[model samples]
Target chain A: MMQIVKPDFEFKKVYETLYPVIFRVAYRVTGDRALAEDLSHEAFIKYYERRNPLPDLKQTKYWLIRVVKNIALNYEKKKLREKKAYDKLQFKYPHFTQSGEAEFIKEETKSFVQKALNKLPYNLRIVLVLKEYAGLNYKEIGSILGIREGNVKIRVFRARERLGKIIDSDAI
Target chain B: MCPDNETLSAYFDNEIPSPWNKRIADHIAECASCQKRLRQFETIKNYLHEDREPSFESSLEQLEIRLAGLKPRTERVSLWKRRVAVPLPAAVIAAICIMILGISLIFSLTRSNLRTMSIRRGPSGTTEVQVAAPIEDLELLLKSLDTYYLKQEIIITLPEDSLFNITGEAMMFREAEFSRKRE
Candidate 1:
């Protein structure tokens, strides 16, 4: 028989222990602190709603990280669609500039490295973020992304190469 | 041939296996180009890590508050919704439609199966009632004969005997005059 568990002391402990790392992964992937916070909360809520806690904290962390990856992928897709629509509008209205608040948010939230990471393709960026920010090995990242370990290694290397070029060119 | 940058990167991450890892390590020790590539990977890794950790205190508080109000749904309810409610609404509706269709078909069939009833006055100054309904319906009709007597246009011209004929069954006659009783 499967037991349904509530969010108890064990859950709170896991949340505290993993929140920082989860937030870091979200932020690095999204490059926006507010959006990262939202995504992190969404991930944890999903975990809490699972009703059956993973056997241990390590498994819980992996589950939460996987959830965050899925949520962030959806967010990236929506953002891409919005950007395309905005670009079309911009083309029609040449004098229109980006909203000041949006500009401010981007400037405030995006770090130099984050900007470089964003320049990499989504696939490479995701693997690299998992590798560096989530402290996941290539095998772990591959497991989360549903790809092979070898594919993960190549993506991480390619991400680093592109990121290095972006940083050197930007001279930041 | 020299190991490509990908192999060096994998070597940097210690993902390469033993003999190849040893070979790459020896090659990097001797090769300046590979060493520079490895250093560049290191620099990039360092750059990625340099971003200061954002404060999560408020976010954690918000999550805690949200989690406080959330109750764990029972496995039964969750499974029910997931398996039966969410994906099978169409199936449920289809089943309901089929049942309704079946019930209506039965009702229509029963209505069609019921034979018509005829009551006529004979040339011998007697009345005859012919019924072709089922046994059950005949019982009910006999029970409700008083209401049907008032509703149906039944007339007997003579105060004589009346014959009752149940088709595909026995015939019964009442010597009492049905017209005399009505009068």
Candidate 2:
């Protein structure tokens, strides 16, 4: 008799296959390893928690992308709240010791590129990472981000343009 | 008119048709500003394309260990059921934690209401007095009294002849005073 496999085991296999990609995407989005792992795990848990199975791998990927995006957005909001609190405390007391070491790395062109990318709006970061690191085409990124393909293309192009200017300045 | 930004973008992407591509290329070549812009775009693209991957094999081992800590010991079974099982408890636990945290916060805010009551023997009757403090501190005080006296138990002999009204959050000791005699 053919043994019946459990849905949970099948779900684990699927998660294992996709976990690496999801981790990379989450890491790029959150810019923190621990946060990336947390977001990825949360995405997986949410994905599996649904009573109905996902329609297909394509849909699953889309769900993962959306979940991670929301998680990263919430994390950003929390960070902003914490920053505001810290600033308020510092302004009031002004006697606390600042944490961590300050180091100056070499002045490389890559630093300029990084600075330029950071200067872009968060929406632009989403588009660029989706296209650049995840290697999703314009239409796929659009579907993932719920924007029109033309919008995705336009944003990415603008991001690249801004980045190019910064890079060229550093190069010269 | 100068070529539109989309056309310029298309030219950067190498997506414009051949004749249009040549036209844009010639325009960019002649225009130092546009040439610089194009070169800048190329540089950004190069930086973006540069591989910045962490060593996944090493990361994967760490992930494996982290996952193992949370993995259930059950053999291969319905993943669908397993997936459903996982988040339900997480949500439930989160709700429970929120409830506990909220209660603690409320308690901390209103802790001044916590009270302690003492009964002392008097000539005509027992007099009951109250002071405010944490229940845990009250219990600790009682426990220490028992230990210091080295008695099998500390019996508060209430004379049942005086009327006393005490209002406090932790009035359970009054009930305990009544309960001990019955026992």
TM-score of each: 0.67, 0.53
Cα RMSD (Å) per model? Answer: 13.3, 22.1
Clashes of 2: 11
- Which portions of model 1 miss their true places by more than 4 Å? A1-4, B72-183
lDDT (tens digit, per residue) of candidate 1 on B102-181: 88667655554445475554344266776565433444555466565655545323323332332222222222234235
True contacts kept of each: 0.56, 0.16
- Residue pairs with clashing backbones, model 1: none
Error of 1 at B10 (Å): 0.7
Quick one: best DockQ, which candidate? Answer: 1
What would the per-residue lDDT of candidate 1 be over residues A1-172, giving only the tens digit for each residue? 3345555688789899999999989988888889999999999988777756688988998999999999999999998998898889889998777795887877766677777777887889999988888888888888999999989988988888888889999995
lDDT, candidate 2, residue B171? Answer: 44
**Per-residue alpha-carbon lDDT of candidate 2 for residues B123-177, written as tens digits (9 for 90 to 100):** 3434444434444354565666567655343444333333222323334566456
TM-score of chain B only, all predictions?
A: 0.40, 0.30
Listed in order, the DockQ scores are 0.32, 0.09
